[model samples]
Target chain A: MQLPVLNNTPSQAEHGAKGGCSASSCGTTDNQMDSLPDSIREKVQNHPCYSEDAHHYFARMHVAVAPACNIQCHYCNRKYDCANESRPGVVSELLTPDQAVKKTMAVAATIPQMTVLGIAGPGDPLANPERTFETFRRLSEEAPDIKLCVSTNGLALPDAVEELSKHNIDHVTITINTVDPEIGAKIYPWIFWNNKRIKGIKGAKILIEQQQKGLEMLIAKGILVKVNSVMIPGVNDQHLAEVSRVVKSKGAFLHNVMPLIAEAEHGTFYGVMGQRGPTPDELQDLQDSCSGDMNMMRHCRQCRADAVGLLGEDRGDEFTLDKIEEMDIDYQAAMEKRKVIHQAIQEEMDSKRLEKAVKAQQHQQEPKLTTRPVLMAVATSGQGVINVHFGHAKEFLIYEASPEGVRFISHRKADQYCGGDSTCGDGESVLQLTIRALAGCEAVLCSKVGYEPWEMLEAAGIAPNGEHAMEPIEDAVMAVYKEMAAAGKLDEKNEAVRANA
Target chain B: MAVSIIDLCVNCFACEPVCPSHAISEAKPHFMVDPKKCTECEGDFPVFQCASICPIEGAILDSFGVAINPPGSLTGIPPEKMAEAMAELQSH
Candidate 1:
């Protein structure tokens, strides 16, 4: 996969990691593999954590059905925008249920491993029964391979459980910060339901009561439930262990402890109060401390309402929220742009090499010796040839400065070789190319020539005088070539190769 | 597996799901238990799966009406967790 090499400087992971990935700048790459989502919590644990080998992988995309939400939370206000469009946040484009279905199909095609389909935030799915159910209805009808998951504050869950069950949605994640209604109310600014702004404690109590009911409903129905517990320092961090205890007792399968990312500018709770986000370690300790009873989800990205893919995966850098309709175009354009950046990198490396080669040939100034003695191979008949044993990419750099337009003559092309060829034009065998390169040669140098070529060449009796030992193809060839050339022995057979070329 | 529904059953289908084969179903006519698929999670879990999470009492039962474990009894966890893990693996 030629991903965009946004950072040519190369990342530490890329240099030493198994994938040999060259892209280091993309933030998503680091967070490529996330904790299994709550929906697939149990099912995914059954699958291999890695693909055979421990290769980091990306999660499937999730599409948010924004138009619906049952009980409104204080923080949620969905006016769709594909804003910066890295993940699902604000939908840049909204879609009809039919349009969403088609768009998911298109997204699945473009992103090969679109494992789970998701709908979260904007509004609870149960609240906007018309839009949410229709989206789920259409998705199940069209593409069933992609697993289904939904996240809600859990307000309208009870009423919608049967519908979710009918579609066989295997996993469900509900965000429950504090079991306390007082705290819950403080967290949420307002709740709009049945056409009214149920504000403060009133709305909080209603939403919490309803959400808890929803969790109970989901558990009773056998839908695997995962509890997303956000840790708001000084708020619910201390109460988290109790949250774990209660949910675990209720048959909740897992608890995902997430850090509250206070959107300072959003005028949200922490932002208006000028509170900073938890240091990663502080959040992790809280998660670890409260992870017994249930499989704790440590790797949650807390993706925007429109988040898709495995837990914590942002498609690109900026958490994006595209309207379900524009998912296809936005993703494709991002992919294409990533490709263009990749192509540009390869071209740069090649040009850099080409420039160096030209400068070496024109300068012809023998490099001053710094360490051991240096050896240079002159253009013998301008058909400079070097026979190789094992072709490696590093072999080409030796003649990188040779005036001898060195032509590599190989017996068999090796896998992953940088440069070498054996096919002879006019059906002659590399005997011709090697002969051309050996033309006017003082001595033909190689590892071990086969009996036939050896016999024919030794028949000329150009003394085979050169140092020999186990070494790389290029080094060995250069060693023997320079040693033989310095000794200055040649004969009639070498003249024949010159004429052929 | 004739059993009474317990208080803990919010009726979330978490239990009915992992039942090996197709045994547990919806709580209709009092959330009946199908003994056929109720290997008591022996196919996976070592003890009665229902009791593990049955917030209420006696949600799971044998044909003879014995609760998987009386509420006051020691937890199904064997004194040796590793031994239980090993024994469960052997059963499979």
Candidate 2:
């Protein structure tokens, strides 16, 4: 089936809207993919992590075959028994190359949506070169249809690039937290180089050089490189903009600035030291600041090393080595089934995009409602839907709705008010903090909200809305704006009365 | 004694406004019980308002931290069976 090209050009009305975004700066996946060459688009068209839209229809799985890391980061605590933790370095079970291939085949047979197989380890993939390459080599020959990718810490990346190019691996992710050695020293305590453990500034310097070199070499070899940076507050947060700039200039296809997961129970060095992760607001702001230079991936779920199923959900427990060994998978029939399912999904998505484009064009022809844009806050856990609960939201995506269209403004971080039952003693203060964080917004849209916050938000002049639960955030914001306009509550004269109401 | 909304509460907004003391306010992850203001429906109603309206089983606990609505009370689906059913559904 021929895929439909996305229509991302902004309508005239949208261009005339206040704080309007140009096609390039709109930050929608459609426009981002449209700008890329056909070659790169084909590579990321079905890879869930690489394209935001692909995640909705396609699923990806990771194999935890590589269990040796060359560098030690303060934030990393690679736990083998952590079944509940959903972070990077935690895997319930480790598999050998043969077991990994068997598991992948079983998953592919069961999950028709599985399109990409990645080797992002509980440790760096490149560090365990033989095991990683062996798994890749076998999979490439046996399951040649599945797109293969690898993620590394870049300590062994420069050395392994030539071997990596030999395999069918087209996508490579390097965790380049910072280009500056000073900030890198704070994150990486030591790196094993030249058969010795090197520590402090000197170790950081060598790691950064290798990462930059590895990134350049992969790009030169026509492989798409995605740079993953952990945003550690006060450590690398302020310096990540420079990292983004450097990576983008060096031809990194996408930059994913992920927040540092520093919960104290994780028992990492930073967590034990009481180092807090970046607030969602800070992470979004940094992402927005760097987005001007290149495409930023905002939909990363930070999957576990052995994560399975779709982006948000994990089904790894069902596909353990024992389970795979017991099951007989006819991969030929499974591939045929997958082809039919994928083609149907593509056709449905193409029609949906076409309908959306037509609606946008019609919206541009409509008469203007008002020149002033109403700002509203949306609670979302990604996928562009208002699907999060009010009290559960760590941050709210702010949107500006005017006569033109709804445009995303920025993210406002809120202190999570409800910490379940064990930590309700500080609820009142946290709610107050959350309210203070959303001072400027006129309404808060979420899937569900408790009554106390409903009253409190209304009292504070910000309307709490749960009616549009699970709706696309932009459509919901525009609906609220039109509701206000239809009620004559959007004019300057009714502002006071509207707030009081 | 205050009735606490545990992690099992789905933030369904069923118990918040029903609280006579208005002690069941919103919080991150789930709702809470404010110890200072909670009357537990004493001198107002015969039973705890929050516990009466809550939909999830074992979501509301008493002062002693024992669940007022224990498992299998509300949904009639046993916790073990519910887990099995949910896992079965998600596998597809």
Candidate 3:
């Protein structure tokens, strides 16, 4: 499939220099804009956080999709409504990728001004990689125009940056409080990586190194990087200038210095122990101090993980999960609607090529496989047609058949696999559960199945037959059984268990 | 009696903005209503402002283990009535 072009373009020095438009100067050259890759241009224009001017005209919505954090920061407590508030760990609703896509489409439709879709976190986005990337992949196809951005604490960024680039994620916000491990230790208590907890300065050092490495990798790929520093009073406040210098030298596009929200109510390790927050003047002074070559982002809202609407003005309440579910909105349809439109255009182009190829080959027909009978499972919507998707199929119809006839033996009920929502369960665990449910069956016949689950099922000795054919389930089952029998692979019981073994 | 905010509280600030005793404060999981200061709006208002203004039902609970603002409270359509209405609509 041809990649969709990113529509929004930023005419900034960062776009010129850091985006590989020009290496020598910050100013845009005559051919710089034209020479820039689609990913960088699209990200620069649509991401409100990166483009200061876009903040005024274009709105961005954050879906609190990632709900797990790999590291513990003294300032963070990842619950509450981070989408509506500016804090990192707070979010009103935690959505799975499916839910996030639905909500994003709904919000985007209702609010025409929304141009960017971001996953900022009630927790570190990369901490929950599966949910985070699945959302991105879905959104890339469903809402291609909406620029994608993700904010992480850099703990999991190293492992995730390459994947993020693959998804065409244009903007990344890495919260790097300080480069110094001694200072980082004061901010972050522990980091959970590779299934081990490294605490104190050691954890801080590892996190810092990873964050820097991740930042370099992202910039090398021409992905715009935004560094966010929470100006913690008496902690990393004095060292933010050095942070800006380091990140800027490493090709960070912008630096956002937000004041630390050290309220007594949060009972944060720092807050309870009377850690003070930087004053407005102190924050401004820090930003000003670092306001040299690196563009200083002075108007950060410190948005919540599930924040919606424009920057500074939060409209999260209007689109709460319950309210959205109640609305007569076909979110799945809305997501698919764009794809159908795009497919129509693609199909039209391919039709000519297909016709030419058919003319050249004279449309030679391939011979069918020999007839045999074997027991197999078939997923059908209704009327004995293989119509339903494998993941969404709730039940599989078991049939035992040969070349002569087929018999409906029984039906096995299985859980519907959902990818986006963590509440449903991880895709791997869910797929395993599904495979176990279909144990003893030689093969499963469905209209379509995802590649990942298909391979997994194949590994477990179950063949996934995805013909996506509009034929009677009996015919489909009989054909496969006949082929097995013809190959002399069917057992005495007319099943493929022995052949598969 | 003080009203307590459970984890279900979305932290929409509906409760915090309308609290009379200034008891509601943002917390880690959700907004917390201070039992020390919470009077359940006994003298402040006829209905608790936080509970009344909350969008999520059953998010705020009174000390008696009952939801001050139960589901259908935000929409003002009781669950039973809504179900009946839905049933009637589906029957058609």
Candidate 4:
């Protein structure tokens, strides 16, 4: 069987993912992070952050205080609505800063995980300083512990950079793909300031000017800056190296190279004439290329402003915007109440099972199918001379790539070395089995594992893969082998695990 | 047969004015990326400018199927230098 592509099993990759993607990088180069003052860089590396399924857990509020933006990009319109929140063909509900704050507090009382607060949206946050700062001030006084994060086009960030540093806000995401104004004109339609509409080349100029100034200011003030660049195939892809160059020079810490997702709903995607969206593979590949000096982001979930919880770990979108508003005041309390409901459901399931069993008893013609399977890890490596572990069995399996290719030669009867476990009992025997299995062939592809087994594998310079649902053994083995091959790690055919044992 | 555009466009316009082979047309409410003329931006820039500029994540996708860069994943000389100094690196 051929290896199914990544799209076939996304859940295995991203569902509360703790580790980084082995293949995709976050477009972060080395020079910027390495050159940073150890104090600052360490803060960044250790920063409690997650992507895709990983929620910031912190509740962030974007007071639509910055109701107006001076600059307009092709991808943006000062529409009374945002595409992320509204249904397609529908518009976002606009709220004043004061109204927004009231709603925020009311919502915060219910969610214990709400921690961060800031202004991020349609217009630049700093553009409307009075409303933006006022919202921040009120939130600070009200929820002091909550961290603040803001995303901006960086147009007016320069003027307010000092003010931002003064505020308790610690994290900032600036959208800057091209430092060159020539290309910038295509994305941004215009920039308005002092009652003047700066069009075309001039608008791009203003944007670049402000982005440079803003990024520098944040770095100087020691505020962690994360630069977000939209990966547009024809427009700025050619120039990302330039973007990477400038971003690194200015001392930016992280680069989020997000793929461009055009939608008629957002108004950001202007022309729908004949273009297509990027496949997942293309996005991962692009992320691998432009991720200069620092780590590349493989796991950008393109989260909503109000997105809640951790990646892969968040079982479902239960904390979604619609669900939260309709949920009970206390979320945990509500969840506990649901557990009660679940317990009731389990009792109902047990009753059904009992009924089915009784029916089978009455209709005795059908045979009862009771198969309590014993799971075993057979090592086909080498024969162990010392205990009954005998490692050679593990070696035999490594030579064959297929189950059809595998032929068991010997069967050993247990009841010999007994300490506890059945089949084979001795701890030494178990060790031999594990070591031999680890040596033969390559990785141990199984359903699930805990830290204990993972650690044992690591100690012996081994790796582990757990793709729970992919059926039979052949499919899983082939897929694992393909990925290993793609990553350039499949060793010689003769490599066996049990030989050392 | 005339090259036809499909219905999956999202108005990203990643294929506009970037027709090196000059095969693409203007976006329709969005635009269609011309693959034949794409040449994958072969002789021009370090990467495809259209794909880079399309901010609508995946709006301007890689039709040519060429692998591009991500953030901070450079293994060799730096990522930027890889493109600008492709010749130099290749010779080495």
Please provide TM-scores, in order, for all candidate models, with all chains considered together: 0.45, 0.70, 0.50, 0.48
**Ranking by TM-score, best first?**
2, 3, 4, 1
By lDDT, who's the top model here? 2
- CAPRI quality level assigned to candidate 4 from its DockQ score: incorrect
lDDT of 4 by residue, A186-267 (tens): 6765565433445667778878988998888888787877778877777887777678657755766666677665543333
Candidate 4's residue-wise lDDT over B1-92, tens digit each?
A: 11223433333233343335566575555466566566656666555554433323323445543233232121112344434443443453
True-vs-predicted CA distance for residue B87, candidate 1, Å: 67
By DockQ thresholds, what CAPRI class is model 1?
incorrect
lDDT of 2 at A387: 92
Q: Per-residue lDDT for A201 in model 3?
A: 89
Off by over 4 Å in 4: A1-38, A41-63, A80-91, A106-108, A269-277, A292-296, A305-501, B1-92
lDDT of 3 by residue, A1-501 (tens): 122121123344336434342221122111212323555544564345654334544578899887656677777643333232346677767787988988888887676667688887776788778888999999898777667888999987888878999985778989999999999888876676543446678989999999999998888877788788898877888889889778877877667778887653453555545578865446546765665322324435576777788665578889888877776765466545544543553454245334433432221122323344455777765433677778877667666454324544434556532234433423446667777667667788888889998999899777898874676565576567656666666645634342321
lDDT of 4 at A166: 70
Worst 10 residues of 1 chain B by lDDT: B71-80
Q: lDDT at B45 for candidate 3?
A: 74
Flag the better candidate by TM-score, 1 or 2.
2
Off by over 4 Å in 2: A1-29, A79-81, A293-296, A364-474, A484-501, B1-92
Predicted chain A of candidate 3: TM-score: 0.58
Error of 2 at A358 (Å): 2.9
lDDT of 3 by residue, B1-92 (tens): 77888888655453564677999886897789889999877776776766654545587788898987565533333566546554554563
